[model samples]
Target chain A: MAKKNAWWLWAAAILTYLFLYLPLVIVVVFSFNDSRLNAEWVGFTLDWYRKLFHNEKMLTAAGNSLMIGVVSSLASTVLGTLAGIALHKYKLRFLPFLVLTPIAIPELLMGVSLVIFFVIVNQLLGILELGLITIILSHIAFCVGFVAIVVRARMQGMDESLVEAARDLGATPFQAFRLVTLPVIMPGIIAGALMAFTLSIDDFVITFFTAGVGAATLPLEIYSMIKIAVTPEVNAVSSLLMLLTLVLIVIASRVSPSALRANG
Target chain B: MTLQQRIGKWVLSWPPLVYMVLFFLVPTLIMVVAAFRYPGDYGGLAPMYSVEDGKVVWDLTLENFQRLTEDALYFDLFIKSAGYALATTLACILMAYPLAWLIARSPKRYRDLMLLLVILPFWSNFLIRIYAWMIILGPQSAFTRAVNWLVTGLGFEPIQLLFTPFAVIVGMVYVHLPFMVLPLYANLEKHDMALLDAAQDLGANAWQRFWRVTWPLSLPGVFAGSALVFIPALGMFAIPDILGGTDSIMIGNLIKQQILDTRDWPFGSVLSIMLTGGVLLIAALGAAVARGGRKRG
Candidate 1:
C-alpha cells in the first residue's frame, strides 16, 4: 500500500526535474544543429563555434563582460566581508527587516531607480554616465546583499569560543581572525565572491540600463545581435556563454551553500 | 562593547552602508522627487526637470497618484501583473513541492548533486534561456508546429499560448521554480517521519496525515518559497517581454517603456513607486507569515 501511494509522488518528482532540464536540453541541441530552426534537428555542425571567433563585435562584448564580472565581484567581496562580520557579530536590532529589503525589491525597479539616480548624478556630478563605474556600483549593491546573507549564515553557525579562546591566548583580534575565524569562514567568503562574480556576468537588465552606448557587455551585445543579426553566430556565442555559466555555477556550488540552501 | 569595538563595528558596516546610501537610497529618494515633475500621469503639472527644459522647477502635487486612479491602462496592468504573480507562485508550489520532497528524502551524498543540478541552470544568463523559449514558441519552429498540429488536428483549437498571459505565467514559473523548491526542501528535511507514522497509527489516512501534520509543518517552507517567487515576480519585466507579445504587458514592462522607451520619467516614477508599494505589502505579509510560523512551530 505504501509503495503504491509513493508511486504518484515519484511521478511528480520526475516531471518537475524534467521541466527544469528540458529547456536547457533544447538550447544545447539546437546550438549544435546545422540549421537555425530551434526545435528541428536537421543535422549537427560546428559552424556556430567557428563563427564565434571571427565576430569582432562578439569578442569585444565578451571582454567587457569579463571586466565587469571581475571588478564588481572584487568590490562586492570586500564590502560583503566587512558587512557580514559586523552584522553577524553585532546583530543590530533596528534592521532585521531593512537588511533584507534589497533582496525583496524587484531587480527591474532597482535597475530603473539606479538609472534615475545616475542621471541625476550626471546632471550634478557630471561623471556618472554609463560605463565601468556605474555598472560596478550597481553590481555591488545587489551582490553585497547575497554575500552578506551567506557570510552571515556562516558566521552565525561558527563557534564563538574560538575567538574568545584566541583572545585569551594573547592573540590580537586581527590575529585571531586571520588565524582562526578567517579559515573557518573562508569557504563562505569565497562562495559569496563566486556568487557575486557570476551575478555580475549574468546580469542583463540592470547592466542594460546602467551600460550606456560606449560600453556594451556580452549579454547586451547578444541582445542587440539577436535583434539585428538573427544568425547562427549568436548561437555560437550562446554555447560559449553556456559553458561560462556552468563553470560559475560549479564554482558557486563548490564554495557556498547559498545555492544548496536555495535548492533544498 | 568597548569604544574601538563599537567604532570598528560601525566602521566595518560603513562600506556597504555608504554604498547603499549613495547608490541605492539616494537614487530611490531622487525617484520620489522625480515622481512629481513634468506634467506626468495626472496631466496637469508644470515641468519640473527635463533635458529640453534645462531647468528644475519646484512644485508639490498629488497629480501622479491621481493619474494612477484615472488610468485604466495602469490599473489593468497592476491587476494583470498581480494575477500573473499569483498564478506563477501557485504553479511553482505545485511543481516544487514534490521535487523538494524528493530532494529532502534523498541520501546526503546525492542530495547535493540534486541541488547542484537544480541551481546550475540559474547561473546561465536568464535572458538567453528565455530567448531559447522564443525560438521554441515562434512560428516555423519545430515544437510550435508540433503543438499546433496537436491542437488543430486533434479536435482542439490551436491555443495562442505564446505572446499570451499564459506564456507569462509559464515563464515566471520556470524562472522561479528553483527558488521555491530549495526552501521547501530545507523545511521538509527537518520534518520527522515518526510524526507521520504516529498520525497513521492514530487512525489517520494518508490524506488526513498530510493535512493535519505535514501541511502545517511545511508552512515555513511554503511561505519562504512563495515570497521568493512572488516578490521577484512582481518586478519582472523580462519574462513578459520575451514570451508575451505587445498585448500582454506587466507593470514592470509598463515602467520600462515609460522610462526607457517613452522617456516619461514622472509617470514612470509614479509606476515605480506603486510597484515598490506592492513589494512592501508582500514583504509585510511574508514577515507576518514567518513570525506566525515560528510561533506555531
Candidate 2:
C-alpha cells in the first residue's frame, strides 16, 4: 500500500515537472524551426540563431541590458553588503523593516513612483535624463533589498565569535572585518551579486517606466518585437536568455543554497 | 563603542538607507502628493508654478480622489484584478500542494535535485515564458492542434484556447506555481513524520492523520505561498496582456494604460495607491497567518 501511494506521488511529481519544463523545452525546440512561425515545425535549421546574432537592434538592446545588469548589480552588491553587515552587527532599530519595504511593495507601484519622482526631479533640476542612468538607478533601488536580505540571512548563520576572536588578536576593527568577516561572507556576497544580476536582467516593469524614448533593454526590445509580431528569432533569443539565467542560478546555488532559497 | 566605530558602522549602513530614502520613500511620498493634486493641463501632477503675466499660481486639488470614488469603472477593474489573482492563487495552491508534498517526501539523496528543478524555471525571463505559452496555445500549434483533433474526433467543435481568461490563468499559474511550491516544500520538508506515525498509532486513519497533523503544520507554507502568488498576480500586466483577450484588463494594465497610453498621472497614481493598499492588506493578513502558525507550532 505504501509503495502504491508513493508511486502515485511520484507520478504527480513527474507531471508537475513536465508542466514546468514544457514551455522551456518548446522554446528551445521551436527556436531552430525552419518556418517563420512556431505554429508548424517544418524542419530544424540555425537560421533564426544566425538572424538573432546579426540583428543590430537586438544586439544593441542586449548590450544595453548587459551593461545595466552589470552596473546595477555591482552597485547594489556594495550597498547591500554594507547594509547587511550593519543590520547583522548593529542595534539600529527600524532598519530591517525599512530595507524590506521595497520587496514588499509591488513592482508596479515602485515603477510608477520612480517615474513620477524622476519627472518631478527633472522638472526641478533639469539634470535628470530618463535613459540608462535612470534605468540603472531604478534597478539598483529594487535589487538592493534582495541582496541585503540574502546577505543578512547568510550572516545570521555565521558564528559571531569569529570576528570577536579577530578583535581579541589586537587587530583593528577594519582589519578584523577585512580579514575575518569579508572572507567569511564572500560566498554570501557572491550569491547576492548573482541574484542582483538576474533581477536586473529579468526586470521589465521598473525598466519599462524609467526607460525613455531612446533607451531599450533586451526585455523592452522583446516586448516591442512581440507586440509587432512573434517570430522564430524571439524563440532563439529567449532560449539563449533562459540558458544564461540557468547558468547564473547554478552559480548562485553553488555559492549558497540557503541564499538562493531566501531569494526565492 | 567608540565614536569612530559608531561612525564607521553608520558609514556602512548609510548608503543603502540613503538610497532607499531618496528613491523609494521620497518617490512614494511624491506619488501620494501627486495622487491628491490636480492633473496639470498636460498630463503629470499639477504644475506648482504657473506664469500668468509674471505671476506664479500653485494649484492643488482633491478632484482626483473625487473622480476615483465616483467612477464605478475603477472599482470594477479592481474587482476583476482581485478575481484574477484569486483564481490564479487557487490554481497554484491546488497544483503546488501535491508537487510540494511529493518533493518533501522524496528520498533524501534526490531531494536537493528535485528542489532545484522546481526553482530553476522561476529564474528565467518571465516575459519569454509567457511568450512561449502564446506559441503553445496558438491556434495552429501542435498542442492546440492535437486538442482540436481530439475534440473534433469526439464529435465536438474545436475550442479556442489561447488569448482567453483560461490562457491568462494558465500563464499566471505557470509563473507562480514555484512561488507556491517552494514555500510549501520548505515547510513540509522539515515536518516530523514521527507525528504521522503517532497519529496512526492513535487509531487515526490516513485522512484524519493528514488533517490533524500534516495540514495544520503546513499552514505557514500555505500562507507564504498565497502571499507570494497573490500579490504578484494582482499586479501582473504582461501575463494578461500577452495571453489575455481585450476583455481581460486587470488593474495593472489599467494603471499602465492611464500612465503610459493616456498620460494621466493623477488617475494612475490613485489606482497605484489603491493597488498598493490592497497588496499591503493581503500582506498583513498573510503575516497574521504566519504568526498564528508560529504560535501553534
Candidate 3:
C-alpha cells in the first residue's frame, strides 16, 4: 500500500516541477523564434539577440545595474558582516531587531517610506534626491539584512577554538580576529557580497519608487519595454539576465553551499 | 570588559546600527508621520507648520485616515486582497507538499540537487518570471486555446485568461512556491521513519500514519510558509499590475497609484501604515497559534 501511494506522490512532484519550468522554457524557446509574435514559433534566428546588443537604452540600463550592484554590494557586505559578527558575539537587544525587521516586513512599505524620506530630506537639506544614489542607498538598506543572515549563519558554524588559540599565543584581539576569524568567515562574506549583488541587480519594486527619471536599471528598462509591448527582444534580454543569475548562483554555491540554504 | 574589547564591540555594532537607524528606522517613522499630514498642492506633503501672525501653527490632520473610512471601495479592496492572498497560500501548500515531501524522503546524496533545482528559477529576475506567464497565457498560446475550447464546448462563453484575477493568482503561486517548498522540506526532512513504522505496527493504516505522525508535526512549517506567501501576496503590486485586469487591483496597486499617479502622499502613507499593521497582526497571530500548538503537544 505504501509503495502504491508513492507512485502518485512521484507523479505530483514531477508535474509541479514541470509547472515551475514550463513558462521559462517557453520564454527561452520563443526568444529564438524568427517572428515577432510570441504565439507560435517560426524559423530560428538570432535577430533578437543582435537587436538587444545594439539597443542603447538596454546597454545603458545594464551598465547602471552593474555599477549600482558593485557599489551597493560592497557597502552592504562590510556593514552586514559587522552586524553578523555583533549578532553572533553579543547579547545586545536592538541590533538584532534593526537588522531583521526590514527583512520581515513587506518591501512596498520600505519603498514608499523611503520615497517620503528622500523627499523630506531633499526639502530640508537640499542634498538628497531620487536618483542613482538614492537607489543605491535603498538597495544597501535591504541587501544588508540578507548578507547579515548569511554571515551570521557562517559565524554560528565557526570553530571558536582557533580564535582562542591565536589570542592565547599573544596575538592582540584585533590581530587574533584578523588572523583567525577573518579567514574562517571569508567565504561567507564573499557569498554575502554575491547575494547582495544578485538582489540589487534583480530588484524592481523599490527601484521603481526610488529611481530618478533617467536612472533606469535593467529591470526598470525591462518593465517599460514589456509594458509597451511584448517582443522577442525582451525575451532575449531576459534569457541573458537569467543566464547571469545562474552563473552567480553557481559561483556562490561553490564558495559557500550553505549560503543558499540560509536564504530561506 | 577591557577598554579595547569595548571599542571592538562598538566598532562591530555601531556602523550597521547607525546605517539602519538613519535609513530603515527613520524612514519608517517619517512615513508614520506623513500619514497624518496633508497633501501638498503639487505633490509630496504640505509644510508641517507656517508662521501666521508670528505664531507657530501646526499642519496635521486625520483627513487621510478618515478618507479611507468614508469609502466602502477601500474596505472592499482590503477584503479582496486578503482573499487573493489566502487563495495563493492554499494553492502553494497544495502544490508544495508533494514536492517537499518527495525531496525529504529522497536519499541524502540526491537531496541537495533536488532542493537546488527548486530554488534555481526563483533566483532569476522577477519581471522575467511574470513575462514568461504572459507568453503562456496569451490569447494565441496553445494553452489558452485548449482551455477556451473546453469552455465553449460546454456551452459557456470563451474566457480570456491573461490580465485576469486567475493570472494574478497563478503568478503569485509561481513566484512564491519555492518559499513554501523550502520550509516544508526543512520540517519534513527531520521526521523519524521509525515513528511511521511504530504506527504501522499498531494497526494504523497509511492514511492514519500520515495524519497522526506527519501532518501534526508539519503545522509550524505550514504556518511559516503561509505567512511567507500571504504577506508578500497582500502587498504585491507588480504581479497584479502586469497580469491583472483593472478590476483585480489590490491594496498595493492603490497605494502605488496614490503616490505615483495621483500624488497623494498622505493617503499613500495611510495605506502603507494599514498594510504594516495587518502584516504585524497576522505575524502575531501565527506566533500565538504556534505557541499554543507547542503547549498542547
**Per-candidate RMSD, Å:** 3.5, 2.2, 1.4
Write the residue-wise lDDT of candidate 1 on B1-297 in tens digits: 888687777777777777777777778887887787765453322456345477654566677678888869788889988988999999999888888887887776888788767776776778777776666666767767888898899899776667888778878888888899888988998998889888888999988988899889999899988999998998899889778878878899888887877767778889999999998899799899899889877
For the predicted complex of model 1, DockQ is 0.58
Ranking by TM-score: 3, 2, 1
lDDT of 2 by residue, B1-297 (tens): 899798888888889889988888899999888887777678776765578889887677778778877989889989998999999999888888888988787777777788878888888998898988989999888889999999999999999888888899999999989889989999998888888888989999988988889998898888899999999999988888889989887899988888877888988998898999999899999998888878867
Docking class of 2: medium
Clashes of each: 2, 0, 0
- Top candidate on lDDT is 3
Model 3 alpha-carbon drift over 4 Å, by segment: A1-5
Q: Candidate 1 at A34: error in angstroms?
A: 0.9
Give lDDT: candidate 2, residue B147.
Answer: 92
iRMS per model in Å: 2.6, 2.0, 1.9
Give the TM-score of each candidate: 0.92, 0.95, 0.98
lDDT of model 1 at residue A68?
A: 85
On a 0 to 100 scale, what is the lDDT of residue A25 in model 1? 73
Worst 10-residue lDDT window, candidate 2 chain A: A1-10
Error of 3 at B224 (Å): 0.9
Model 1 chain A poorest 10 in a row by lDDT: A92-101
